[model samples]
Target: MTVEVQLLGGTANQGRVHRVGNTVRRPLRPTSAAAHALLRHLEEVGFDGAPRVLGVDEAGREVLSYVPGQAVTAPPPCWGLTDEALRSVGRLVRRFHDATADFDPSPYQWSPQVPAPFGDGGIAHNDLNLDNVVFRGGTAIALIDFDLAGPGTPVWDVAAAARLWAPLRDPSDVTDVRRGRELHRLRQFVDAYGLDAEGRAAFLPALRDSHRWMRDIVREGAADGVPGFAAYWTAEAEARAERARAWFESAADEITNAVT
Candidate 1:
């Protein structure tokens, strides 16, 4: 059967993605085998939010079920910045984590593995940036772009999500309604995810570490000549990252208070 192809946007990977009927097609990466296995596990466990991998296509691209929803982009709209939206994102991430908890990752060839300060345990969707999520009715519904998924802890994964969705950032760099509500948003996320006392204690510090981790990745990707990361590095990533680091340090007390 012949199908029309539509190019996808909002991705930073150096691969072209296209939509074909009810599925998406993208060039396979070196880590594609691992990502495909992860997706397969998600399907076997009946997790509806993730895409179902359909093996390689005639053109040798990886095919995935097209999750129908709007991908939230940068400078997030007011809807994506709401307290309700923040909670929703947290819950979705928690669900994904729970589903993948027992998945044995030993057989997979995952790449760019994240170093979790807590322990090397659960597999996490390491990159939960705004653009990687799909939203509907002003709420986060599903996550996409699994190329960065790898072994890590729930706290580590949640911390990364909070860094983006709860927006643990320098106020100067934030442009949405979420600008001044970092602490509040962080608390809301913790509450929604039902983090325990110990998890709460570790959350703030984990978030700080995530900032450094992300900045390093951006710099590394740019150095490797990836256009998207290169553009961000050249634009304002350095200054923005430094300021965010300082802000996370200064707000550490407040973040702890909110979550604890």
Candidate 2:
């Protein structure tokens, strides 16, 4: 009998992911079919930065190939905080977007939470949070947790990544060494991703939308009493989010100048 090791990291799916041999078992969701198809397409296109979708298990869990790497979790490690790791994330995301360019997502019943005008570019790895990406040899190698994977633009994905990686938040909320260097990191990430001039022009607006999008998800999740979301939706968290919005509004020109 194979032992099941509970995988940690990610608040949304906390305690729901397990490792059995060389596979990962996760709870099936309404969006699993879409996610599975997306993974299969990635494989067909030779993208190795994501997990492979195996059949469902007897217990009704979606089985996937276990990718071995260290995810950048809370209170990130020194290696995960490096510019190299950030650049690697940019390259990985670029590759993922390129691979999915031909995928048609109209048939799949994607998550309804993905707002309009945002999902048309292609099927994107909507949640590119720090913990969602896996790193090997101090380099970002793969992305996990496809629960939020669905219709999205490449710029949207880049914005999500920048929001979390460069962080784009109130400096007071950032206790790490990355506190004052958010804009510099943002420029580094976009440069590494090779975002085109047109994409660069649209990035700041996408970043604003990305911020609102994520905040809404967390708020709705907390309202529905999801244990993890509820815990994270404290007054402090709300205050910080508000401050981030204000900061983004005030720094819009500065941010635009940095990336362009």
Candidate 3:
């Protein structure tokens, strides 16, 4: 019998993922079919940065090929916090966007979290949180957890990555080596991703939107009694969210200058 080893990290899937040999088993969601289709399309187009859908398990969970790499979990390892790692993430996201350029998302009902002004240019991973990215030797390799993958623009994806990876949060909240270098790192990320002038121009607004969108998701998840979200939505977390918003407003010009 194949042993089921639980995989840690990620709030939404906490206590749910298990590794059986070289496959991962995850619970099916309303959007799983669409996510699976996206994965299959990525495979069809030869995008190796995502896991391959390996069909369903006997227990009815979706099975995916195990991507062998370390995810940037809490307290983030030294390698995952380097500037090079950030750049690699930017480049990887760009590649993912390019791979989805010709995909037809019209056939799938995606997560309804996609907001306007950044409407469906292509399917985006949407949740590029640090833990979603898998890295080896400090280089980002694959993006997992496609539950939030849906209709989104390339800049939107870039902004989402920047928000989590560059982590445009308030400095008070960033206690690592990345503390004061947020905007500088954000510039490196965008440059690595090779955002065009137009994309750069739209990036700041996208960042603001991305921040609110993610905040709302976490807030809703907590309200709906999700254990991870509930645990994360403490009074301090709420205060940090407000501080992050204020920081964005005050640093808008600096952020704009950095990316431009």
Candidate 4:
């Protein structure tokens, strides 16, 4: 196969990702081994929404199946910011959670787990932001960028996904038609995920935690000078995080009432 490389663009992680043929080549990180094992497990369970982890290449980069679709990124296009799209992501995350239910993470070293409640049992995609989800024809088709995958609960994963998709943020900061539908979308997401009473009850706090967890991650990456993260940190990431926190604070009760 021709080895011509194409760089993937985004303002999140620092890794260099390239596309060659139907495969994605990414720089290996400390958590790569655990991520590989998790991908293999997902394949073993017949979950096709995640990429297949093909071992490393000659250059020492971790190779993975290139999921062919458009990745919805920051300032996502209009199609990616719809209510239907939000619900579809909810179902996709649920499927990922269910498929990972039987997998164990004790055998491999992973990135540090997110803080409590989220840091419990089960392997979560951890970072399910819109940028990590690949969509085709406006539907979520696959998940990518598993660098943050590690031990966590399904509810925690859902919260992370919701914070990005439902987008727990102030109306002024939100860029799409979803500005005023935050609570409405939260209800839609929880309903689509089929959360139980307990999960519903825990949703708000998890949402709060997820928001802060992401901020800390960005701060660390920026301090360490990890590529894209540092740029984001210097720009609007922290301010956005604070604004999101404030919005969630005011909207939490309404979200809880709707979820339960």
Candidate 5:
């Protein structure tokens, strides 16, 4: 009944990661055929940029291929925040977008529809926090943690990625010493992704709204009994949310003009 290995690592939000022999099972997530179908479609028609579906584990957890490479955790030295790394992440994301452009929409993660005052991006890994991105050769070559993947706008995903990589945090949390350089990274990312006029135009507000939207979900997950989520709300989560919302508000014109 049992035959495998178990390893531990960080998750995008807060969850358990277990390696059972040759496969990985992410806690409290689904391994639906639809999800597998999406992964397969990405492999077949689009970019082969995602982890492989390995069915369910013995404990009925979502099983995925144990993707290799380093996840970019924070407290990074300045080099880890290099322009080249940012550009690589941007390019990889663009490739992912291009790869999945032809996907048929159905059976997605999270809600199938996004609400007003906030435009949602299409099917994507969605969470680009440093932890979810995989680095190789000093570049983010792959992505993990598709818990938030779903139907939405490329704008939302781009903005969210920009928030994490371009950062969009208050200057204080921008602690890599190369501080104040995130704007340049932001520009590089948008340029690499080739977000057009409309896409860019939609970015600023989408970015701002998405922060609150995401916080709402995280807190909701906590409220709904998702383990570990509560820890976030009680910690830097509130401060980060405040910082991001404030920064986004203050930088509204600049972000809007940049994306425009």
Candidate 6:
């Protein structure tokens, strides 16, 4: 999905992101452009956990405040998915929600003209894809990609994170090789987030809805002819999604039983 590369001599992890520099970086819809800016605003206003927007670069590629660290997409086999890590992620998101509480919608805020699937509230980084998060020193520190940020519900945002970390996706999709363990991970994350009985009980089911909705939108992107999304949704994605469906079904019982 990375189309271009340039050396900006800043972040070590992502290695110089704004390569297009003052030119059309890649084929993007206008809203994508606005997202970059919105993320910048959030950073300026104390939402520093995510990438900072550095304005359009030399070639007009969006220059972002690159976060330097590791984004653990999957927990390693030897590495246990610790409660600490889950809590760190929860705290990071909580900070973001709080920071953006007073953020005004510049450039029409998140989801400008297009109606977002989620409601408006704190700038929700609806896309909590594993790769979008940055972890340093054993704690979740920063998040990137405000591309999906918009007026969305706290439940929707939390559900999105759970879908990845609780991993509402298929069990097989979990690279950690843990079968029913992710259920525990879900509990850890929810507990970290300070959710009450209502939020905890509703977590997995809400995540289920997010899972179905998120994938459908990705599929929709393919149908609508978005390049990167289309490539994914075309062939392998379909089968992968099926497996995810099965995996989630297999874990449904544990999800129902788990307590945060």
Each model's total of backbone clashes? 0, 0, 0, 0, 9, 14
TM-score for each model: 0.93, 0.97, 0.98, 0.94, 0.87, 0.76
Any runs in candidate 2 off by more than 4 Å, and if so which? none
Residues 1-260 of candidate 3: C-alpha lDDT, one tens digit per residue:
78999998878778999999999999999999899999998999999999999999999999999999999998789999999999999999999999999998888878866789797688788889899999999999999999889998999999889988887988999999999999999999999999999899999899999888888999999999999899998999999999999999999999999999
Specify the highest-lDDT model's number.
3
lDDT-based ranking: 3, 2, 4, 1, 5, 6
Worst 10 residues of 6 by lDDT: 7-16
Better of 1 and 2 by TM-score: 2
* Model 1 Cα lDDT, one tens digit per residue, 66-87: 9888877654577877898889
Report lDDT (CA) for all predictions: 0.82, 0.89, 0.91, 0.84, 0.71, 0.63
- The per-prediction CA RMSD against the true structure, in angstroms, equals 1.8, 1.1, 0.9, 1.6, 2.8, 5.5
Instruction: Give the worst 10-residue stretch by lDDT in candidate 4.
Output: 6-15
Error at 236, model 3, angstroms: 1.1
Off by over 4 Å in 6: 1-28, 32-37, 73-83, 106-118, 234-236, 243-253
- Tell me the tens digit of each residue's lDDT in model 5 across 1-260: 65555443353334467666666777654435556777777778746557887777657678888777676665564555788888888888888877767776654545434445343345656677777777777877777776666666777778888988877778887766446876777888899888888888778877877777778877787787766666557657788778878888887877776656
Tell me model 2's lDDT, rounded to 2 decimals.
0.89
Cα lDDT tens digits, model 6, 47-127, are 668766555544555555557776664344122245676678888888877777776665563443223444654567777
Q: Write the per-residue lDDT of candidate 2 for residues 89-199, one digit (tens) a residue.
A: 999999999999999888887775556567677777878989999999999999999898888888888988998999788888889888899999999999999999978
Model 1 TM-score (2 dp):
0.93
lDDT of 4 by residue, 24-93 (tens): 8888888888999999999999999999998899899998998888878655789999888888888888
Of 5 and 6, the candidate ranking higher by TM-score: 5
Q: Whose TM-score is greatest here?
A: 3
Query: Model 5 — TM-score against the truth?
Result: 0.87
